[model samples]
Every structure is written in C-alpha cells, then in structure tokens.
Target: MYLKDVPRTDPNIDPATLLQLARDVLETEAEAIRQLAPRLGEPFVQACRLLLACRGRVVVLGMGKSGHVGGKIAATLASTGTPAFFVHPGEAGHGDLGMITPQDVVLALSNSGETSEILLILPMIRRLGVSLIAVTGDPASTLARESDVNLDASVEREACPLGLAPTASTTATLALGDALAVALLHTRGFSRDDFSRSHPGGKLGRRLLLHVADVMVKGERMPTVGHAASLAEALLEITRKGLGMTAVVDADGRAVGVFTDGDLRRVLEKVDNVRTVGIAEVMTQGGVRIGPDLLAAEAAQLMERRRINALLVEDSDGRLVGALNMHTLLDAGVI
Candidate 1:
C-alpha cells in the first residue's frame, strides 16, 4: 500500500465525497488508456501479424482478475473474425494445456509479468512451438523477454488509492486486446457480412445480414393487380395477399405504381363508385422501392424516412420481384 496522504478506507464517507472519489478514479483510468494509445507500434503490429497468421485459434491465458479480462478479450476476438478462446492457466497445468496447438497463438496477460500459474505453463507452450504474445506492465519481466511479441500494457499508476489493486493496468490490457482484434479484423477484410455470420442469433447480426430477398414475400403470394383493374379488385388482392398493399403492374408485367389501404380511404372519400374507379388514378406513381439485395436494416431506415410501412421489391427492369413491410422486418429480427 502506498500514497500515504489518502486514507485507506472511510466508513462514514459522505455521498458527495464518494461521488468526487468516483470521478477521480474514472479520470485516472481514462488517462491510463490515453497513455497506452502512443505505446502501440511495432510490438502491437507484430501481435496482430502473429494472430492473423495463426492457422489455429488464439489461446488466451491469465491468472486471477486478468483471467476474467482474458475471457472477454477472447470473446471479442472470436466475434470479430479472429479465432480465439480463453483457457485458465491454473486449469492448463491440470489438463487444459492440450488446447494450445502448434498452429495457435498464446496471448498471456499478467500485470506484474510474474504470475506463478502463467510461468508454470510457459515451458509446455514453448515445447509446443506455439507463438506467444505477452501482455504485461513490466518490459523487463521474464514473460515479456521470452514472448514472440511483447505488448507493453504498462500504466503510470492504479486508480486504487492504496496502489495495490489492478485498476488502470487491467484497463490498458483490455484496450490493447481490442486494438489487436480490430487490426486483425481489418487485415482479414472482415466485412459486416462476415461479422454477421459469427453472430446470427442477435439483433446486430440480423440487421447486418438479413437482406430483402431473405424475408420478402415472393412468388405467387406477392400482391399485384393490373394497372387497368378496378379499385375494388386491388383491395381484394391486398386482402388476399395480407400485405396491406398491392403493386399495380402494366401489361408488360412491370410495376408502374402502388395502391395501399390509405389510397383506398382517399378514393372512398371522393368517389361514390369504388368498383368503377381505375387503379391508376389512386396509385402512387414511381413509388419508393427496394431491391432484393438491400439489407433489411437499410430497408427499415428507408421506410422510417419515407414514412411508409411497406415497400415494393423490384428487379433491375422494374419487374415486381417481392414485397416486404415493417412486420416482415420485425419477424426477421431486423427491426
């Protein structure tokens, strides 16, 4: 314990005093991240290269609090297109060391660079010939010296008033792990489609991967009515298709406009004979449409901007291909 000026613990600390202390701790940690920004250079790039070249997964290892951080880092890497998984150094000695293959990369995290459990497994990893990327606060520590690439996650000080707890150091290490993952993601050309494949069960995945073709109501079920058809016929098509709207197509099977329930209401207000009115008179000409390749998220944004619930899907030549609405997007988890 150091920093004698600050008390170890105050049982009766006031709410205002506690708030200020929390702010101070946050500011200290923020400064630690800023300091780590400049330290990213060759060693950091080397770690990315090693990971990118790794044919097998990246095996993350750490002890105590660092182990918790390592697990999160592993998850982030795996989700971002970098193959990785975490293994407890303590458990590795018992049996988990088999997870480290010759083609894999080992990222060991230890603030002090002298964790007993991590050091014990060093010889086994070395014998396997797996590349080692060491993350530590001490540049001269044994872990750093022996690593294939050393990332200096050193922080000036800990946010802990006693200066013994791992606070700023762990933050720096976590940030470094993120940097490596993002770098590898960029080098591997990890597109949104690629990221979505790794996360198919969540809203983020659906928004990125779900396309108009994937959810659009295609084939015979698509609501379509001839441009010369009566308004009543269009209404019947809408009802039968259950899409709340119908595409008005010309003789060439090309959509010229769209007629929705809102259009029906307006027609009824002005025209007494709904059955006799032509579909073209009440349809929205050159209406907003989307392609089958457009992402469902993009389609949702367009619908929100245009203030409409449904859109007509058309091919390159203006042929009606499919139909989709807000409900379709919701069903696909894109909304």
Candidate 2:
C-alpha cells in the first residue's frame, strides 16, 4: 500500500510531532473550505434554482471519492425537501442511465472536471435534454463548459502531504452540498414536523410528534384537590397519585393553582400546625400550565426552564384535564 510521491514518516518523529502533523491536516482542510466561500456566487444560486424548478429528482453523478460525497449529498438533498438520488456513472454507462429523465436535473461532481466515467455519460445526459449542474475544481474544463450551471468548489490545496488525496476538496464539496440542502429547506419552509415525518424512527421525530396528551395521566388518574382543602388533604391526593403534586381546583372543578411537595416543605417550615393551612393560602396561583395538544418536548422544556418537575395539563375551558412529569416524559421517550 504505497502512494507515489508520499513521504515515508521518520520513525524518529516524536509522538507530539506526529499529533501536530494530523492537526495540520485538519487545519489545512478547514482553510481550504474557508477559501471556497467567496467562490460561491451566482453559479451556486443558479444551480439551486434549477434543482428547485425540476419536476423530477436531482440525479447526482460522480466517480471515485467524489461518488461517496455525491451519495451523501443526494441523501441530504432528498431528506431536506429536495427529491434527489445518486447514480454511479460507471453503472449509468451499463444501462443505469434510464434512471434519469429530461424533467430531472443532473448534479455531476468531478474534482478535475475530467472524470472519464462522468465524461462518458455527458452525451447520454445531454441527449435526454436534462439540465446539468457541475460541482468541480476546474471551472474551464469540459464538464464545466458543458454544464448549465457550474459551482466552483475549488480548494487552494489538498490536506495530503503529497497534495493528491481527495481531502480538502471533498470536505468543501460536502459543505457546499449542505449549504444547498439548507437553502432549499428554507425556501420550502421545511419544519421539524416535516423532518420528523421523514425520520420517524429517530429521537428528533419522537420529540416533535409526542404530545402532552399522549404521555399525560388523564381523567380520574389526575391528582386534584379543592383550593379550600387542608394541607393534609392535598398531601393525600399527591401521595395517592404519586405525582408529588396536586392541582388545587375551584368549586367549578377548574384548576386555579397547584400544591407541590416543595410548597408543602415551605409551609411546614413556617407553620407548626400544617394541617390548619389551606391549599389556597399556600399553593402557587396559576402555575405555568400547558395545553393537552402541546408537544411533549415543549412540556419538558418548560418544566426544565422553570426548574419544576411536573406540568399541569388544562383544557380549552381551563379545567385541569391531566398532568405529566419528568418521569412520564422519560417513560414515553420524549425527553
């Protein structure tokens, strides 16, 4: 496994120097991507516009390392509001070209702008009359010249010591792909819910889709006591419901405030006869409340932000319908 022109590392090079060499590679690649920033101008916008207007999918094509990047770019585009998929140029020559159509847009990647396999497919793509967008290092090469839009993903130098490996250039192309995907996402107003729909098996989907109603203890399971109830009565309800808190409702069975273990502790410190105190006198009035339809993650966020452990769920009529806590959220995997 020898690469031409690559230097053999001196075994004498200390561990510190070896680590520094690795760090330099990362820094060089970062700078290369930084240099790519100014090169993104009208061409990038034109590429996005073409993809946006396409009635069919964005067909990404590349060879070698560029193919790997193209696959990831296609996945990102497809998941982020753009319809796209990658087709290997080698496979395309072997009849996979049928996957593309004139209604689609072709995204071709080649660092040298002269990948033979990609070059081989140019005629078939043109024959189909689909617009071509080239992401390449060479702006004046054959691929660029033939493209309807040429995005300059050129880098000043490769991070490889021999300046041969597809290091910096590949990173820049991936960043450019991400930029395009995010831009399209913004224009299409893609939301967390939409992303959740595409990735329902992931935690992000559960966070966005799980609502308070789905995780809350509703109906008779909810812990409640009248505001006029004594501290002993409120404690009985809280202990019975195992929520560490009980809603203090009014005569209409609508919640007005909440009494928690924390409040009970405070009341005990101030009053010797805790049983004499009414929940209305000690309960927190109109405690931070949420609707049943509120996202469970939002509920968790509110409880986290307010440094509380539980949330009281209320209906449109302001009646206490349910309750949830950190435990409930964790049990439902919404945290």
RMSD of each: 2.9, 3.1
Residue-wise lDDT of candidate 2 within 192-292, one digit each (tens)?
88887777776777897888998999888889998689988998999999988888898998889988888888888888876888888899998879999
For model 1, the stretches where C-alpha displacement exceeds 4 angstroms are 1-15
| TM-score, model 1 to reference | 0.89
The C-alpha stretches of model 2 lying farther than 4 A from their native spots are 1-13, 271-278
Q: Give the best candidate by lDDT.
A: 1
Cα lDDT, all candidates? 0.90, 0.89
lDDT of 1 by residue, 158-187 (tens): 998779889999998899889888988899
Candidate 2 positional error at 271, Å: 4.3
**Model 1 RMSD in angstroms:** 2.9
Locate the minimum summed-lDDT window of 10 residues in model 1.
1-10
